[model samples]
Target: MTIGKRLFNYALIYKKTIIFALLMLMVAVAADLAGPFIAKRMIDQHILGIDSYPWYETDEGENAVLYQDTWYKREDHFSVDDVKGKEVRVLQVGRDYVFVDQPVTTPEGERTYEDGTLTITRSNEEMSYPAVELTNDELLSFYMPEVDDLFKLILVYFALLVVASIFTYGQKFFLETSANRIIKKMRNDVFTHIQKLPIKYFDSLPAGKIVSRITNDTETIKELFVTVLATFVTSIIYITGIYIALFLLDVKLALICLVLVPILVVWIKFYRKYASKYNHIIRSRLSDINAMINESIQGMTIIQAFRRKSETKEEFEEINKDYFDNQNKLLRLNSLTSHNLVGVLRNIAFVALIWYFGGQSLTANSAISLGVLYAFVDYLNRLFQPITGLVNQLANLEQALVSSERVFELLDKDGTEVCEDKMPRYKGNVTFDKVSFGYKEGETVLHDISFEAKEGDTIALVGHTGSGKSSVMNLLSRFYDTKEGKILIDGQDINTIPVQMLRQHMAIVLQDPFLFTGTIASNVSLNDPMITREQVEKALQDVGADRLLKNLQNGYDEKVIEKGSTLSTGQRQLISFARALAFDPAVLILDEATANVDTETEKIIQDGLEVLKKGRTTFIIAHRLSTIKNANQILVLDRGRIVEQGNHDDLMQMRGKYYQMYQLQQGKQSSLAG
Candidate 1:
């Protein structure tokens, strides 16, 4: 799918909520801008320390008569010595100097200053005075505002903060909810695509590897949505507004600090490329390592019996070493992006600051206030922050692109089965006409194999291992289609039917029966939520597996471990038979159905086969010729073509390949008895 289309699909379900989240994010950006502006105003107006003193107006230019006071120093030299006899109290002393036990509060009124006296301050509530005597200038000129103005500024700043918090927190909650919803929908889409993917995909790709792409890779992309998109957008707005404010204050200072920004962007671009490369290498190798570990563990029994433990361990160590090496490369790239870039960018800004501040324009001509210089520095720091996310997000974006390519590639391909327009139902009849197949290109495992088995016919396909018996089954199931001919069900070619429909119409019992991990009822019913417990019990009875089920502690509720590992092979095979029967298919095929069974299971299989074969086309594939003696038609295959064909008595009278195999088995049994 196209990126825009996929994004629309992810958000279309909750479009209204997502729109609200986007609006909140914009508000958050605007609110974040206010914080620095508020701080700069606070410094310029409330903390304007030196500018609080009195000034007398001076006229210099023609038509100009106004000037503003910046600062004034006291001219008083009054000294206070503690009185020896008089009790300390708040009392006026002869209009010269006031004396008291505690420091005196200059009340809100005019106060005089001379060259050599210290003005000690106390509670302004103590007394009142003329506005001029309270400070070196009128009360309006001081850094601390009058009561009314303080309250006004407080109310405005508080409102700004409250709005900022609402935007910030509300944006976070809704963005996360929307992103999670998008991710959930994406995962479901991936799963649907995986189910529909051709069997060729499962044959070539590792299961855990696909799992990592679906789960881990998708989560990495989610990080971009959850944090990077939001932070980067807000930071950009903050940086732009700060840039504008700085330029208005002093253009030269703003220009000097901005010189390092482009350099940092170039630096980020350089490291992002290296990070993506390392990340890909790490991702691919992790898939390989996961495949190896899974296989080694699953084959542990074979490895131990064959004494290949050390070899397996060495193989794992090699892959493990490669995984860590690639991880280290990613770590180094991450470190470079965060720490090293900060140092270089900061150093360049510092050098530019020195040149700008030390220039003749700044020193002599321009009166750049310290507040403006400080704000410019803050803007300089903000400029490079989002550039860092852009760099790291490039790496994150790479993971998303790679995984998307894989996921969409699978989604784009149709299953091997041809799904034609039909009623999506079937009748019971199977016929293979001159079908030829192979495992790979230019390979013909089965050549010109024609077969006819009508409904209710028991056809036995006899062949040795690796002689295309399984390939025949695979072709009929459309796991791999035949190259030379077509397979028909009833009067219709199978290519005209959907895979699910075809599978629903047939059942397969392999040489090695596989079982899912679940309760006995679940295994029997194949976890079909629509299938009732009664159906499971009936299937178990049909396969003679109900006896074993009843012997278990929970009967139908008995749980099977992974792949039914807790059960014996014969018992597991019986469960597989029950599962196949539960589906109630019209075509039943069994390859070595009872070849590995004991005398007891052999008896059960004989009884179950009679019931299962009724009113169905049954194809039995076996290497043991004795098992097919009673078949309706037995075809003996050598290499990829049938060499002999007859009933049991007719084959024995002919003394052909089937006869020779039957004689050999009988001779071996007789020798062992003697």
Candidate 2:
């Protein structure tokens, strides 16, 4: 599915809230659009109604103005049953009201009153009528009948305004609430999906980049939901309301305004053409900057120690500058397209209105009413507001699209499902049959490797760097699946088992132990429900972590910060060892677990290793040959192949690569001692 459709699918999760918000929005728009029509009625029917001719003399007292000695009422105020006496006209000619006893043939012409006579002239034609001028007091009395009705209309308009305000608030509240909820669900899914992704997927991507996708990119998407979505929906509805109002007022002008819809569509297409490119670059650079910052923070010790601070600053500044430049480009595009485009289109609309209305006025009897003209102008002005809003939100729309694409791209990656099903513990019998693998295609990291370890056996793998020692452990742990051959555990192919369930009965302590930010006990137990407090304590005691951790005031409860930076290397390693032992795995793999510690700590860990390996098959990947001398079997790897395999005495008797490596390491120790 397209990114837009994917985003819409997410919105569908909360469709009810969005639908209700849209309904509220429509009501609010309807209420607000009623204002201009009410004003038209007020202006035409009440305020300007006095100029309407042919007042009838009526006997009814109500709405009847006593003019001179006669009771006169405007035709609109005359009741159906009222008795009529004589016809008269009250007309406004050049801001002065005149009382004409008899009606003129036509009221469209210019009028001049002189010497008790009213002369109407149109195109060299003239007619005259006997007239009388009324004072302000008399005119006020004539308008008294409309005062009550006008006040009522004003109240109605105010009530409509109040209704509009209330519904507007409702729409905004619901829309923002839905927006926050959508973003919350999306963030949770992204984080959850990250767990399902394979370790190799993270191998080529930086932690910082992934962090940016989850944090910065998702934040941009939230704005798309919160601000962009609301603005676009509201603006579209408002524009539609305005168009409908315009059509009610004048069809020809409304049809002319239809041109704006196409213009706006084309404008968005053009804007996105450039904006998308800039936004893609901007987002990519932002991820790069995040990655670089993360790497710098992680390696700050080396950076500062080597005095590469200036170089790192320059590198960061370069990426930051690129990001800034692209942002400025997007800003320029928005500035040129948003309000500026709306202003030009608004000017065009007004110019067209002037030309159309001006042409109408040129006809012999063509004249638009004041009320109709006022409402048209009002509706026209209102139309541009939504257009401006929509145009302004285009940048955010494009940005959100780019961010969504990134997020969805991550979500689309193939990931393993975390299975929670229980599998009965099997005997610790592992066998690798002609196994060969590589992280990438056509780049073999491990050659046809075969090995076997029976139950209760200790198998040690010793090799130089880049000699596939850790790769063998990785294959055993199923971090990466091998395509060439099969790995069996307890006579069953490891690939047939679920990764999570397979790992449930296995444990590994890495060369550089990683600890989370928690108490030392929690790190050992990993907050697993199966491992009780007693098991955690026993594991710690068995791993000799108590001896190293006892100096701290909290002892087993001592706080460990990120990556166990607050504790010593030996302390972190002991915690890792305790963690492995706490699980009591059927197969235990220790990958150079003692490579970074001092002799005393290694000796303490050696004792722990003896206990950890009992009655369980163990695979040890060690760089120090002395550490694995007591193993039942030792496999010495060269390149991607195991060159020699035997007991320590047998390897020494064979005088092969293992013997040479062991002699070299022993010679180095002897020289250091001398």
Candidate 3:
């Protein structure tokens, strides 16, 4: 789906809240709109006293009159039954007729006059007289109650202002809350989806770039919901409402203001086109900068050791400069199209209004009244304020769209292969049937490979670097699918098993074991509720890791710093071995697990491995041949194919590649000893 449509879906989930917010916004807009109307009424009727408009006063009979496309109440004369204390508004006055606020009511079957004049006769009709015209001063005499009610008018106006403020605040609060909720969900969904992506996806992307998508991009989207969205909605309403008021006041002036609509549309269309493009570049560059920074921080020690700190710094400076340059481009665009440009448009509108009205007065010897002119200017200013606001929000809107596009791009990619819902547990019998694979397409690294490990057998893989030992391990775990042939667990296709279920029953102790920042017990059990404390203690004890734990201040509860940096290589390996034992996986893969430890530490790990491998099929990928000398079977791989396979003694008798590698390693050991 398009980013726009996807964003709409998020909004739809909170439709009720959004609807309520919009309604509140409208209520606030209505209250705000009332301000100019009230000002106009005070100026025209109270201050200028423009005309005398007649109104009816009667209590008993129904009265109705039609004037100027409106209907009002009219009576021939005042009656004793007339309501005693109600003040009537005089809406308009002319030589022939008058308009009023009172509603006109006619008897059901009476023949009524269409014009202002009306006559009625009855058995007990009261005294009556013809409708009379009143002067502005005479009308003011009837408007004495308004003068007395001035304080009440001011209070009501202020009350409406308060209502507007309250509703506006409510609208803001709800919109911000909704935005936060959406951003929270987006962050969670992105992070969860990241876990489900294929392993190869991570190989192609940096951790920081991925993190940027989850954190920075979603943060940018927040403005869409909170500020940009609110501004767009409220500004549209304000613009439309202002135009409506303008039309009601004077169609000619209103029509003149209509020119701005097309201009604004064109401006936005042109601006967004370039803005989105620049913003996309800006976001991508930012991701690059984040990736560089993350890599620099993580590998600071390596860079310093290699004496390449200056080169790394230079490379980072280049990336940072690229980001800064792109940002300046965006800044320039914003400078051109936003507030400053909007100010020019606003001033142009004011100049146009003045020019048009001034021309009318000069050419026709007539002009709109000062009060009407003032109200027009007020409404016009209100109309432009929102337009200016929209212009100012353009940059944020563009940034949001760019960020959303990147976020959705990640979400749209294909996830890992699907597996059966109910996968059976393997019984430690693994088989590879002429399997061929690669980390990427068209680059096969493992070809026509076949292997088998019966239950409880320890199979060893010995090979030079890039000879497909780790690749086989990865395929056995189904981290990558076979490009050709098949891998099976207990005679069932490994691909049929869910990755989670397969990995749950398989444990890997890597060459460099990783530990999270938590207690050793927590790391061993990974905080899994299924692994009891007793099981963790026993697992550590069985792996000879209890000695390392006892040395710490808190046995089994000692805090491990990031990546177990505070622990010795052997200690970390022992903890990892303990972790694998705690889970008691049906299959174990040790990838050079003791490669970095001392001979004494290796001996300790070797003893631990004897226990770890009990009743489980094990695959050992080792650089040190002596470590796997007693394996039940050894497979020596070369150029993506196993060239030698047999028991250690059987391979030694053959005097093949494995025999040569073992002799080479012995020479190195003898030389080091000398």
Pick by lDDT: which candidate is best? 2
- Please identify model 2 stretches exceeding 4 Å from their true place: none
Judged by lDDT relative to the true structure, which candidate is superior, 1 or 2? 2
Candidates 2 and 3 compared by lDDT, better number: 2
Worst 10 residues of 2 by lDDT: 360-369
Residue ranges of candidate 3 with Cα displaced over 4 Å: 50-144, 359-370, 417-424
Instruction: Put down candidate 1 lDDT per residue, 1-674, tens digits, no spaces.
Output: 48546655666787787678768866765665555565566555444422322222222322111213222211111114321221211222223332222223342223333443324333332242222123223333332233344466667777877887898788778877877877777778777777777677789888877877677766765765666555655556656666776677677767876665677668756865676677777778877877887788788999999999999999889988998998887777776677667677777877787677656333333444456566666666666676555555655655665555555555566744334443533556778888887778998889888877777788888767777777787888877777888899887888767777788768888777887877877877877876788887887788787665567888778888888888876777778788877777778889888888876877887677777777777888976667778887777787888777767888888998888888898898789889
Return whichever of 1 and 3 wins on TM-score.
Answer: 3
lDDT of 3 by residue, 1-674 (tens): 77889999998888888889999999999899888777777766555442323354433333333333333332223356655333233433223223333333321111222344333223334222233344555554444534644566677789999999999999989978888888899898888788789888899999899989998899999999989999999999889889988998889888988989999999999999988888998899889888998998989999999999999989989888988888888899889887777787788889889997887655423446656788889998898889988998999999999999999999888886544364445689988999999887699999899989999999999999999999999998877899999998888887877788788789999999999999999999999999999999999999999776687888889988899999999999999999999999899999999999999888889999999999999999988999898899899999899999999999999999999999999999999999
When summed lDDT is taken over every stretch of 10 residues in candidate 3, the lowest stretch is 104-113
Candidate 2: clashing pairs of residues: none
Q: Per-prediction TM-score, please?
A: 0.81, 0.97, 0.85
Order by lDDT, highest first: 2, 3, 1
